[model samples]
Target: MSQQDPSAAPHDDRPRGDPWHAFGYVVSGVAFYGFLGWLLDRWLGTDYIVAIGIIFGAGLGIYLTFSRFNRALPPDSSHDQHEQN
Candidate 1:
């Protein structure tokens, strides 16, 4: 058996670090909200709710995408600062 290094971080094998993930999130958001709006419209006899829901879903998706992808990360102390001895 090989020994593992305790200081090494574990590798992530998932493929979520891509732009497609954001696109999927946006599309799914829009579809889900649009479906909900369609149901509400059918129940309440409104014709414009689906459009409004689609727009709202798009806005929400954009906000979520930006929040997840455009976040400002803190400076890395290991590389940005030198240790003072």
Candidate 2:
């Protein structure tokens, strides 16, 4: 039986950081852009701009969240090529 390394990090099922962080990003994006669109619609007397803004905001939020969180993750070492050699 091999002993566990004391310096190894503990395994966790959940990713680090506030669970609401991603949700907040998406909600804030939608609210902000939707509000902007609503104001634009009022100013320009248009009907569909608010809907467009909401869709755009949601897409932007998802992209932003993906870029922010996905890039920060460390590459998996379990498949490290050098270790197999």
Candidate 3:
């Protein structure tokens, strides 16, 4: 067996997970919030303005969620290392 170098940087072995999970969660969350807002507005009979606000809030939540996953890198970056050189 070949000896391993302790000084070398450790390699990542697991498959790189997608960063889009958060985005999906955000989208679902927004849809849920929007529905709630619409229900509340309809029940209170204050017009649809509150519903619109709820939609905007949902959009914001989606954006933030997607942003969180925007920086995700692949599990194996050997290709990246080669490209960098």
Model 3 spans with C-alpha error above 4 angstroms: 1-7, 10-20, 50-54, 70-85
lDDT for each candidate structure: 0.78, 0.79, 0.67
- The number of clashing residue pairs in each candidate reads 0, 0, 0
TM-score, prediction 1: 0.71
In terms of TM-score, how similar is model 2 to the real structure? Answer: 0.65
List the RMSD of every prediction in angstroms.
5.1, 4.4, 6.4
Give one digit per residue, the lDDT tens place, for model 2 in 32-58: 899999999999999888998898898
Q: Which stretches of candidate 1 lie above 4 Å from their native place? A: 1-17, 83-85
Per-residue accuracy of model 3 over 1-85 as CA lDDT, tens digit each:
9987885766655434455665565677667777777787888887675567667767777676656645555666665697889
On a 0 to 1 TM-score scale, where does candidate 3 land against the true structure?
0.43
- Write down the TM-score of every candidate: 0.71, 0.65, 0.43
Evaluated against the true structure, the overall lDDT of model 3 is 0.67
Model 1 misses residue 41 by how many Å? 0.2
